[model samples]
Target: MEEKKVRIHLEKHYWPDEIRARRKRNLGRILALVGLVLTFVFGWVVGSTFATGEPVEETTDFAKLEAIYQIMSEDWYFGKDVLELQTKLIDDAINGMVDGGGDIHTSYLTSEEAKQFNDSLNMGFVGIGVQYYDSNGTYIIERVFRGSPAERAGVLPGDIIFKVNGAEVTGIGSDELAAKVKGENGSIVEIDFLREGVTVSKKITRAPINNTAYGEMIDAETALLEIYTFGDTTGNEVMDILDDFETKGAKRLILDLRDNGGGYLSTLETIGSFFVEKGGILIQQEFINGTTDTSKSSGFVTVDWEKIVILVNGNTASASEVLVAALDENLGEKVTVVGTLTYGKGTVQTQRPFSDQSILKYTIAQWLTPSGKKIDGIGITPDVVVELPAIMENGFEPLEEGETIAPDSVHVAIVSLQEALSFLGYDVDRQDGYYSPKSVEEFKKYQATYGTTVDGVLTQEWISRLHADVARVWHEE
Candidate 1:
């Protein structure tokens, strides 16, 4: 027994070391499987992100963008030019900010769109300055600018632009349709429209619409002037009207700018000279750079201040407003601002032809009054705000007593008769939305005043006098 105890050093198994080594081997196997799964999941996520097929940001790195672009080009993922893709991206970005739906006043331009945009700014286009958009998935004209080709062709404000040159224009984007309507100056463009319950096909010629309103005189001392624009020539045109008015013995004036959009700044400056005596602050342009001061009568234009009225509405904007503000400040009672507030466009825009052979127009300055009133979003309120009083269907018709008028039909046909009667201050009390006997009587009086044919009916000659009167007084002011 003693010998056995001394000799027995039998090897005991090293259980802890063996078990530790085996555990480590098992952990390595598990880690290998997890890494495989992670690689597969990451690849799937990357693929899905690209293949989602929607308009979205591709990636945030130039290298990623380059790689994706190269793959698309070489792998034939899409059948289109890379430059075209870039152009489309640019167009989409622009349209998001400035398009038919973005701002009715501002729009994005393609090469074709550039043509249409340039045409609009130039006031030169064929298919009547009308634009259409999808409503309930069908296209409809949003509006037709007054005196535009469409309007001249008797196109209504709500007419639908459906076909151009015999092509279905439905779902045709606004930018594309606008391009189709624009063409070489003086060229004819054909359009098919749904107007007043009838589908009419009309061909319209494109030209630069004149910005000057036609002038007319009502009675001596009462002039009616219709202002179309405030272009550079407008000042000279008003001067011409004044010379003519002096001949007609017309002293009281009425300026009508109901549907006139705006134009050049110089014209307003010239207008200010007439009512604003000597050189004072007519209008000041506040730009990012500095303020531009425009003084009154600098070039020596003058106007009669005794009795003048400037008529304006939502359409009167830009330069027309400058005249209103100046006259409102200087002429006071001598000038009567008789309509609603004038359009409050205080910002100035400038156009320059680019070296890239493209032209760009940008907002340059904001306008301020001599009293330093900001002109954007807030128009000049008139002194005597007189609306013709909205009548039935719209009181745009003659203020007759017992007659009813056809909707949207020309009151012009019978308006002269009523307006003539109104001049004698006849029974305009009827305001019956029709031409009546009272209107007839007024018409006769106007005819007698002009010593024209006493037809007892409103004729072109009678209308002419009224228009001239409005043009002389309101427009020149």
Candidate 2:
């Protein structure tokens, strides 16, 4: 058998001790991610080759394959096409990655394989399937979709795949891994994974993934929307939600953009256009030649600008950040953003097809807003910041070390809320230790002014505004 070798390029730089330590910690997380995104790809390769599939009469045909490849390389000449050279090279490289798997969830694809693998994400697949990614690597099956083949096969969320049909699939990429697991409908794949620290093997059929990101509100004006990514349909979904809200007399909106990573930039641009008025910048996009252009809203052609209050957190990234930043900048008077700093991702990426089977999607440019604000590494700050609940506020959830909020919380929160209301120009009674309907009503009135959901609940937003540095009074300004 002919052996293949790979060359890895490294950027020239000296690493610090802290960076090394951080990398060490990041390694496990990254591998775990590989276990998810690449899990399917690894599973297919291992299962097809192993997993009781028309049992192989002979273990492998690498020798025969090598002979065939040698003949193609030497005889089958399209006259030394450089394109042909790269194709052959990429094919060898991908096969090597798949064969090097340590777990069923990890597999490598050649550029072509990677393209087929990634495109499959939008095409077809099934099982109690879930997909996720991180800086560490790509992941899958955080939560199995209900009624999926994987779910019926007893696969639970967070079940880590260490192998598939005896092939170790650790550290595989998302594009590659997705390619591995996805097959034509009615195809069967065997997956070996660890659940609750116990190793298990299961055969599951693949199915199409039907995902929805919008969750409707019942009694409250706040609808919990969990966008997995900003795809081509994302803008339409958002617009539909806004239409629903307006139809139901929703004067205030809380856009929950937690844990959503970015996808299509066009979706963000479209969504931003719905909220911002026309002829104004929504985002500043730079072209490859260094020419910068701004994506502006055609107008407030969809929803009212002042009615949205985008809720963000550490996991909110990419398209989510774009929407949040746009609303924050354009609807400052109407929007009262709350939650933690966002996952700042202001870069643009485009996918370019190589061959019939492979494609490459790489980041092209970093983005800025019309105001020239950068959101790349430095995340967007919330207008009002509220720390996550250290422990259950009602003291009911499981308690662990370093979890519980101190006893001084209630007094502190009440005092802060009172102070914040005053700072935001609420005419509430002075510094009252108690929360009465009067206080609540006064907070509601202030919220009404800024278009927050007027449930009359003394939320952290109200408390935050109390603690904020007051802007000058309208008359004075």
Residue-wise lDDT of candidate 2 within 1-477, one digit each (tens)? 885432111100111110211111112222222322211121234434323323223333543334444544665445276445534443443434433343222233335444334333232344336543221231324445434677678765545555654665645764456556666677777777643334678887877664435646655555444555565466676778777776765655667776566656666777778778887678887767989977788774654533666777787776677777787787777887788887676666554443332333344666887788887779888878987532111111212323322222334344445555655567767454466556667766765765557765554323323222221121122
For residue 471, model 1's alpha carbon misses the true position, in angstroms, by 22
lDDT of 1 at 418: 45
Best by TM-score: 1
What are the models' TM-scores?
0.52, 0.49
Instruction: Find the number of clashing residue pairs for candidate 1.
Output: 30
In candidate 1, where is summed lDDT lowest over 10 consecutive residues? 6-15
How far in Å is the alpha carbon of 437 misplaced in model 1? 35
lDDT of 2 at 302: 51
Model 2 lDDT-worst window of ten: 9-18
